[model samples]
Target chain A: MKSVYIVDDSIISPLGFSVEENLQNLKNNTTGIVEVKDTSIHTDSFYGGLIDEKRLTDAWDALSEIASYTKLEKMMLLAMQRLLDKNPQLDITRCGVLISTTKGNIDQLKENNTDRAYLDTLASAIQQFYKLGNSPTIISNACISGGLAIAIAKRMIQAGHYEDVIVVGGDLLSEFTLSGFFSFQAVSPKPCKPFSKNRTGISLGEAAAATWISGSIKNTNISEVVEVVGEASANDANHISGPSRTGEGLYLSIQRALDEAKVSASDIDYISAHGTATPFNDEMESIAFSRSGLEDIPVNSLKGYYGHTLGASALLETIIAKHHLLANEVVCSLGFDELGVSYPIDVIKKNKAIAMQHVLKTASGFGGCNVALVLKKVSI
Target chain B: MMVEDYKITSFCSIKDNKVIVDNKVLYVHEEQGTVKEFTKAIYKSLGIKYPKFYKMDTLCKLGFLATEALLRNAEKPDNQTALVLSNRSSSLATDRIHQESIANKEDYFPSPAVFVYTLPNIVLGEISIRHQFKGENAFFVSEQFDAKLLTDYSRLLLDTNKASNVICGWVNLDSNKYDVFLAIISRKGNTILTEEQLNKLYHT
Candidate 1:
């Protein structure tokens, strides 16, 4: 019956490396998705949310001379470092670490003769580097992993074992994923337009986001304090990769979240959707929102701003939503100009000022996994 | 931390387009594939249904079966439940297969069919659909079995009231074999089980 509040958040995406940079771009509606000229891909035009490898060198100093660490590690370390800087009094040992990622050094896997050694090596290296050997845990539940990571951390803190939880979610785009999304016919040739009549597919992206959650109030400097009140998950037994036409899983998850939070569907002020821009994903989410009685709520997807960051999507989007909540402004759904789906809803097209006391972040993924987390602005 | 009650509902596995279970062997007559096929066969048997599961790779199939079993036993909770899951390699196996399809000259074609299984939490998606038990869901990867972590995570969910019921477990699948187990623990005092009790149930 305790509450978990967001103490701090950090994001490193194509929009820019630091949280401030991404926020500035988001506020200005400057998208990071762009056409790729790489020859490895079959498509001549592809948009992706890419990170600056050159900017990551600054994070190398935090590394403990560990040879096994990869670029993704440094990205996560940098984001977390920034988060700690914002809230220096956080007790790392007392906080549970929840990590959300889809592919961990999978590019290494693609290289012939590589065993599963990368996992142990990376985990150990991270633990040693952060001195978080006992507290770290990783979540790899496909796209919903980020949202789920926050849910897990909230769970542990509520259980009384940990007072603070550090949730980190990130993934790097490699040939491993580009080929897979390409194979599924799910990759958008151009920058993705969520809920557009001509919406193509999800543009791949790579980024890292870290957040601090706890019940105790530590930082007074934070402008807006948001509390994650309810969380839920469900399985869509319908298909492996495709979602159920009814969106039964998403509906169940949201309903459960509302019930636990002791709130009604009408109470939600806004919805930070998992509009991946894929044909089926956008349509299904619209339908789910409608069926859940969220038709009137303002909806938007951050995909245009950061591409589909995969593992980092939920957390990154959550961080964006946090910033918006603090700023008292909701960024418009960047690439959406029309209500492409049959479902009746209002998709914001421009940055709008609104008094949002509660917002719901929703995401669904391949195995028919659906997750929804409800956040309330705390009146500290 | 108590499981008032739980059940395994629908379970099925698909290998070579045929479904197999504890008693049925669908591939006994087939010539052979490889160790991959054998591993797929094990995953196929672990499921509760065949036709629907045929499309999924190992990770999705294992998650679907385990989550289906979980919902079948426990009634749809009155409130939202939390999902805390763990796997060893995530979707690396499917990623490897997908990567091979494109990188190899002989098999330069990419199948959207095969590419869809690369997401680790696809099983959670599948479970969300079947049970409509949406609360909080998360999947984690560990070097080895660690039930303490699972219990600790579940306790967090319960204590925060972020989830009144937490369905937590482990489901791992790769080229060699697969193992799956899940439980829905409640924050309510009734029908609770401690970490030690849950560990015994899974390990023993």
Candidate 2:
């Protein structure tokens, strides 16, 4: 099997437009989440990480494009362009594009004609924009879409389907998602506190995170390459909206991922968990980590900074994890002051320098889906 | 890479008011009606007492019924049976309903029940809970059914020992039009499962 390497990446979010800027903000412990008061999205004030519209517009304007595009499209296109620019030698014809999004143009739902609201339409627009070789595969498996896209890309490359795959995960904060989360009473009133005793619930956010995964390393400009060693997804088979109290699915996913990577739980150095901060979700993750015998590994949830970007959450977090591995420093699990869950997993409370080679990225979402991906740092 | 040979153990298709299993018509409604009515009729014919079926959106109902039919006579599949499903519309049918509930401020009342189905993969969860399948699963969206993608993915899972069995196909619903095609692929079966075979079954 071919080893999948993350050769290049980019992120467009409230914190910054590039990976370097985002990493700088993380190192400085700067949060992108803020109190959002947009009536168009919600009736009352809520906390979320929203990109500066003016800044985004200015960035898009610099592209000098004559075509009109939606906010989500602009974010996705800009992110992909940045990644492609970094790897100018990439052959577009041999590459495959995989889009991970829960809701593409969902904000376009209010219009009388919702042709643009289709997930495939969002993918087609990107395909046409890049004139890529193949139609983009759309992964809409809730929050796991982003991380799962990376897993599938690995499989596609290993199976000799493509030499390189570009995975882009993006979602927008619209009334459609906001009202739904509010209806579920899962939205936190303040900045999200993942795995904290006082944590209330998730803070919704919007972002576009893209990465280039190849069978062989490219982009010699980078110092180190992050290889995707093992990836697996499992369904809870318990509930669609709620996570299992036993964390059965997550445990299975982690075990399977570890097995595939030919590594033990003790081999993992850090964990980037899907700590949505909802009491049930955080607790479930703790239980799963305990079951996997990884309770001693330092775990951090970036939700405090970017909130929950839904489909973009995992990919964005993975990119941050790559940087963490490159820098050999683990960022703080922001907003965590006290242990919240019953299990005794080590939730990183402060940014600290540490020697790390292997990082585990896990995400669980609606439809009882859970994914675990094992990433290892290899020197060029 | 060495390829593994797999077979289609069972198959089911729900479309045009007809329910077909393994190339045999199991049930067909004579009267034209809404997707809701057609799905309800199919559920009644199946005679299974799963009350949760009533609450699912049209897409889930379609997928749920198709899976129930696919595994009706066969032995219970392994708990590690993965579900790889795809469709073009995604959960747009339920998304439209959720959008309508919150579209107007005066009538804003988004029910958690309706909002949960807004994701396409929820159908997989519903089927998983029903069959006690705690296995790998994924939901993909394309302009139309892509046999190569589904087969390639399912083959990867089987070849890598990630899944014991796979229930893979397309289930799409939009504007009252519905189509569902589900098949169980395993190491044991009569017909070989491949991209060409899946395409033929989908067209059938």
Candidate 3:
């Protein structure tokens, strides 16, 4: 199989608009999550991480000339443009475009903007505006969509369909999603605490982040090469809203990814888990990791830093994981006061520096979907 | 490049309130009713007792019924079978229902059952659970039924050993409109599934 490397990336979140800023905030132990009383999305108070609108608009206006796009559109476009600006040598017209989201423009439903609620509209608009290589393909398998997008891009590249792919993942917090989670009683009132003894549920957040994955380094001058080695997606075959009692799906995903990456469980230096902080999610992940012989690896969930961003959470966490690999450090799994889950697995508690090579990223979502991707930091 | 060994083992189509398997019509609705009623009527013809059928959204109901007809006679498939299904409108049909539940002023309450089916891929989960097949699955939202995309991706899964078998095709559903086509793919089968074959099966 041909190699696929993470060439360029950008993250737009409440923590910051740039990768450097987001990384600085992570280093400083600053969280984007906070108590939000936005009755527009929910009637009662809820905790979430929301992007500052004024700053977002200001940043977009300074760089982009088009103002017809919605706020989410601007966020995704800006995220992609930042990467495009940094790598002018890359060709937008030749790279595949993959957008991952559970609900795109879903906010339009509440505002009577049904025309924009179609995910195809958002994808086509982005494709036309950027003149992407091909019509964009959307992965909408709940929260695992983002990780599956990267895996799909890698597969397309390996199939020799495209040399590069731009994967942008984003979702907005709205009444539709908020009410759905509320009905399920899955939203936390306070900041989300993944793997904590008192962990309640998820804290819904929103952000748009993009990563430029290339099959080779011939097009641009990128030095830090984090190659996407192995990836697998599986269904729990258990429940739609609940996780499997045995964590079978996630365990299979990890095992398959490890086999594809040609590495054993212990070879994985660090793990960036999909700890949604929900009782079922964290417990399922622990069982999955422990069953896969990943019990002792330092695992951290970025949920506390940025509330579960839905489809963007996996890619956003992956971007941060890349930063961890480059710096050879592990970020603290915030909101985790004590270990609370079935089975036993090492959960990183604080920011610590350590030499890292290969890292594992895993995510599970509604519809019994689970995805695992192994990223290797290699010196060229 | 297609997987040389793979072929379409079986396929079924459920649309126009008719359940057709391998060009044979198994059931057809007679009365004028909503898609939900049509689904219920057709599922009754199967004579199977899976009570969970009634709770699925229209999209999943159609998909489950189609898969049931296609696999009724076949042996149990391996757990590593991958599901690569696509659609045009995605879960817009149920999205509208779920959206309405939350958008109403007087009855403004979300139903977890309806909310769970708001995403298109929940059908994949439902199918996996009913069959106990845990494997790689994805819900792709395309502009339309792209047979070439389905053919190439399905072939890749078999060739790369990502899945021993694959259940792939387009399953689109919206209000008063739906086109569901599911095919069982594997390395040992009678008929090879090319782009042209997929197109033919879609319109079959």
Q: Can you tell me which runs of candidate 2 are displaced by over 4 Å? A: none
- Deviation from native of the Cα of residue B168 in model 2, angstroms: 0.6
Rank list by lDDT = 2, 3, 1
Candidate 1: Cα lDDT at B96: 72
Q: Candidate 1 chain A vs. true chain A: TM-score?
A: 0.95
Q: Which wins on lDDT, candidate 1 or candidate 2?
A: 2
Worst 10 residues of 3 chain B by lDDT: B1-10
Which is better, 2 or 3, measured by TM-score? 2
Question: The CA-based lDDT of model 2 is what?
Answer: 0.92
In model 2, what is the error at residue B153, expressed in angstroms? 1.1
Task: Return the TM-score for candidate 1, rounded to 2 decimals.
Answer: 0.85
Mind giving the per-residue lDDT tens digits that candidate 2 earns over A234-273?
9999999999999999999999999988899999999999
Q: Please, what is the whole-model Cα lDDT of each candidate in the order they appear?
A: 0.73, 0.92, 0.88
- In candidate 1, stretches whose alpha carbon ends up further than 4 angstroms from where it belongs are A40-45, A58-68, A113-121, B1-49, B59-85, B124-137, B153-169, B177-192, B197-204
Worst 10-residue lDDT window, candidate 2 chain B: B1-10
* Model 3 DockQ class: medium
